[model samples]
Target: MSRTTPATLALDRAGVAYELATYDYDPKAERVGLQAADALGAPPGEVLKTLMVKVDGRPACVVLASDREVSMKKLAAALGGKSAEMMKPADAERLTGYRVGGVSPFGQKRAVPTIVDAPAAALPQAYVNGGQRGLQVRLAPADLVRLAGAQVAPVT
Candidate 1:
């Protein structure tokens, strides 16, 4: 096993149960969620991706299913913001200390408001990036909420 990443470190410190899954990563892949699902033999819906956006000039982390898109209007309404836009890849990397495909809700370089799709709360477990590409962490949704200080909302 390699050294724990920021995401895994947060999970460990929170006493959250999780399984680490690592695989060969292809940088050219277009859809990272689909690739991870295929590699892990899991359903696409069970694998969620973390997206960073600027909500009312502040950073907010949005976690949604790999198969779905974040509803910007709905997210704005839920966040009490007039609008939300996806952060630039460079800004996201700078803010989270993780690259585009490897953004995780926990252990970001800075604490940001986080919102998770309601469906994630219904799942027994979910696989999210482990703070780096080619690695993922399988953990309980409740633990994710607690660790990220995320509110459950309908993000898609």
Candidate 2:
């Protein structure tokens, strides 16, 4: 399958090293990240999930391990905000210019503050959405942090 998405293009432009892979996307799965981890033969910790959230009513991007859950309290503290919550699917799609399951932190429509969980940062490599359903981009965690200007924090 062609992997030339906005996310890929952004990586290309940045000259960052990355790889792409695809899997059978299960829309019916309870958690898309878990399904992706299982399908990719990767540990859940190596598969990162990109979540669109609002911190004090403003949008932000959060990257963390699929096996972990973001603590809203920690998220707020990390971003220096008073409160945080998941953005509505439609709002997230609109803000990021990607469908819910396909949202990638690499090439959002508008750049927002980003945070990479400490767990993901500790990984040598990690996988995140490739701006499309069933597609994943694998790269060094350091590259992700650099490319996204993401603050590393213990949000999970």
Candidate 3:
């Protein structure tokens, strides 16, 4: 088998069954979710993206549907932090060792606190970035949470 990325490797090591999908990447694209959905034939809502944010001066990860936006106030309150703000793309890449379009909850350089939108847990499976811009991993919601050591909350 070919060597997988850190994110996919972590999922495999954790015994999480996932399907890897690769697509042609377009850097100028605005809606990554729509692009992925169109390319992979998955629903926009079922494909998730990992976002990096700062909560009370600490870096954290928020997983939400690609079509939705993260409510900073709700996220901060859920995390018991005073405020939350989106991390800069460069900062996110530097911290996670993955580029902006390829951030994944698993296999980050640093183990940051992670919160997944409650609705994501209800999905049968979700497609998330596979630690690389051109790749994605589809896995069960339970497995994703287990692999990422994420907390379930209302992140959307």
Candidate 4:
């Protein structure tokens, strides 16, 4: 078994029950989330891709379905910012303390504002990166809200 990442540790500290899943990772895969969904045999909608964005130059995370695209305008509006842009990969890695393909919403190096798209919250459970590639954590949507202190909004 792989070592628990800060994300899993945070869940533990919060007393949240979660399931850890690991699979063979193809580093060359184009879309990280789709690869994980295929490897885990889970529906794309059940797996969310955590994206880091800069809203008004402040770093924040947006969690949306693996197959969906985040609307920058909607995101900016939801966060009450004037503009939204995807964070540079290098900046994202540096800020989150995780690689580009494995940035999870939990246990970031610093706690940045996070917005969970409404569609994701509608699901009973969702899979998110567990702070490393090929690792995923499945937990109730409510747990994500409580653990990450994420704002539930329609940012997708």
What lDDT tens digits, residue by residue, belong to model 1 across residues 89-127?
999999999988888898899998899899976789989
- Model 4 alpha-carbon miss at residue 40, Å: 0.5
Return the top candidate by lDDT: 2
Evaluate all candidate structures by whole-model CA lDDT and list the values in order. 0.88, 0.94, 0.87, 0.90
Candidate 2 regions exceeding 4 Å error are none
Q: List the residue pairs that clash in candidate 1.
A: none
Instruction: Give the CA lDDT, 0 to 100, for residue 56 in model 4.
Output: 98
> After TM-score superposition, what is the CA distance of residue 5 in candidate 4 from its true location, in Å?
0.6
Backbone clash numbers for all candidates listed? 0, 0, 0, 0
Better of 3 and 4 by TM-score: 4
Listed in order, each prediction's TM-score against the native is: 0.96, 0.98, 0.95, 0.97
lDDT of 1: 0.88
Candidate whose TM-score is highest? 2
* Candidate 2, run of 10 with poorest lDDT: 1-10
Per-candidate RMSD, Å? 1.2, 0.7, 1.6, 1.0
Candidate 3 residue lDDT tens string, 21-69: 8887678889887788778888889999889999988999999888889
